[model samples]
Target: MKELLILVVVTIFTLATYYLVEPFAHSQMHKHVESEHFAYNDLPKLTATGDATRGAELVMGGAGCTGCHSIDVAGMPAPMDAVTAAASYGVNPPDLSNAGAVYDAKFLAELIKNPAHALLVEHKFDMDKGQMHPMVAFYGTGGDLDQEVADMVAYLQSIAVKPEELTPAIAYETVCGRCHANHYAKWTQIGTTPTFKYEKESLAFQIQVLEYQDSLVKYMGTLPPDLSIYIRSRGEHYIETFMENPQNYLKGTAMPRVGVNKHAAEQVIEYLKDSGDAKRHEREEVGKYVMIFMVIFAIFAILWKKQVWRDLH
Candidate 1:
């Protein structure tokens, strides 16, 4: 009787599962899949057969694309001269060859529009390092300049260079030069780092700084609420320990533990504590407050001028 009962239950489950799930399986429409297959999965898919004729003009124009890449467009020269010219200013351009082969036009455009998704995958989504930078930042997470990225992609796709063509010096120039364009960038230039002094400042500034820290942490999908104020509240060792292994410090924390095995965590501590700007986050806090205030003030002024505020009384 027990054997018969087990057989009956199995039969019911099999019949029910097949009947209910089979029809849905054919369409798979239940899952909201925007795109499962990346057609630009290979270089051949992205290679353009159309006129890259006008693409050259867009490259040299105000887009500042020559800022990153070395294009072999019709009007422009090969590379050595143009690249050497830039090295004088401690700038090295990136290779544009085979870029089309590496990514499709759409992928290229998205990369420029929003670097967060375009970058090295280890930071977040391991699958997408598509055409984005790992270290360098661009638009996304409130980033922009989409049109420029489009133009830049057009230029990159026109060229067809090989991997060996990218030299070590050129690699450093195109990638790292974007930000550290001034100091710490010039291989020939070296000096003693100056200690900034801004220990004493406005509490309001400090508070906003704290908030900005929180925003960055939130963006990274790690610990929320920044450590700016913790200098006094939590102390240096507290910072050091968390920096060492944030996961260890906070169980089940999203912080993926960056530099515990190496002494990188300690180095970060030294860098942060000494850097006086940490006490006063210039762009992060103050800029955010200014932007928010401007938006609010504009709304209020508009309402007042239009007599909306008066009518409320």
Candidate 2:
């Protein structure tokens, strides 16, 4: 009993020390970002509800979105191929088919109006050098810019895929695939392929990937790392907080605050876990059984000790 009591006390002390010391040590190593630096908190709210039909017209014709982006549902195909688009725009423009589904409405509006400001990347722009964000800002000829933005958002929302239709892979692709590749999941910036049946197709895909990466490097000054192992390396909490406001975590980082709402963020994280820690669910299940077995074994051991030492008391 005395030995057991000492072991329990030591375990408690170790746990207490770990819980206290780790956070303090981490704080010392990394500055804690204030809440003010979180861009989502300062998003411009919509003044009026949007009309989807009007928004569709604006996106298709007035805004000329199809010149750069593709909306398959809207029958707007990409004007340029991936390599050409990347070379021209510093990155291939993402298909807007699922944009409304994955991104927050407010963010979409802001992104259309001022891509740099919306992405918290205005610092990258240099007025003196005439360097601007690749995405051109949209200021509608209409008197009410807010109404036009709202209409476009409404159109996107109307055509967005149903919430249930968004798989983890799709969500990840829509949200992060443009920058980060997940080799484990067979996903790249351009698209996904499980296996290449033809060498020609394989080579073409590789070339496209390289072109996109090169363009991104020119735009952002560094290649974004593959996300295949980030879930395991960075852990969930860190990824979640970092995604909410990347600038807060790494100031001057080209990574934007993507404005993924909670549900979309969860789906993206799920995809990362699926790619990085495929056996997490199995490990958790095994851990539960192991804990139960230990508890049962401890009870039996205590009973056995009492049975063997009843006379000593």
Candidate 3:
């Protein structure tokens, strides 16, 4: 009887060990990103370095990263290029740090590759729609993508994350990726997405009302409305209504309906009001002038390249 009791204890101990260590081990393998409260693991694996330097380059050099995001923005236009800072769709530049820290490499890879479906299966964020970036060029073609996907995974994996300021994949999936992964992934393959984004660098509205910022018609053609001071200038009613049915309000808008409930949308509103959009708007005028120069330079470069090729031939 004593021996039997001893065996039972050992079995229980082993089971406990399996349950606890399995998640950590699984996390190390690249399928899981660890967060403070929960862990999300659904995609393949991620890389160690997220290529933040490359990401920075993409931000510069006509890559137009600063087109639609605000990080420490102040003044009229934020620094960077692409166009004036705008926030047409009531969107904000969701921080990308420590995204992998929420789950694992695999989870992040899937989020980066196919954000729409990936967010749904993972039950991370509760977004009504999905994302529309250029992560995967050929997601819906019904074919295998081993290496190209791996590289994209690596690029996403290379991002450096802040362990302390980590958000759960569940929350991100619910609130973020659900709206754009599919759209952006689709756009990536066909290269049909907009040229510049609508973030900090773009032209932002000095007023924070939830109404469209189309005051200027000349540059407004390809720009989004600003949301920097929405809660302060406009009020909660506009913010909430816009969040609920953005499309009904925007009329043929590229923004998705994330289905932010009253409560959730309120929380987001609070977060936005508390958090500043940075001084990104300060760089706008500089970037716009620079972009014009870049375009001229690009045209000259193309012409020069043609001449060089002809001479060599």
Give the best candidate by lDDT. Answer: 2
lDDT of 1: 0.43
Instruction: Write one digit per residue (lDDT tens) for candidate 1, span 157-275.
Output: 55744344434333323322222222222221111223436654444445433343344334445424323334455555655555444443565554432212112233334344433
lDDT of 2 by residue, 192-225 (tens): 8647899998997898889888998897799889
Clashes of each: 5, 0, 62
Ranking 1 against 3 by lDDT, winner: 1
Q: List lDDT for all candidates, in order.
A: 0.43, 0.85, 0.41
| TM-scores of all candidate predictions against the true structure | 0.26, 0.89, 0.28
Candidate 1 shows a clash count of 5
Off by over 4 Å in 2: 33-39, 198-201, 304-313
- Which regions in candidate 1 have their CA more than 4 angstroms from the true location? 1-51, 72-93, 120-152, 161-313
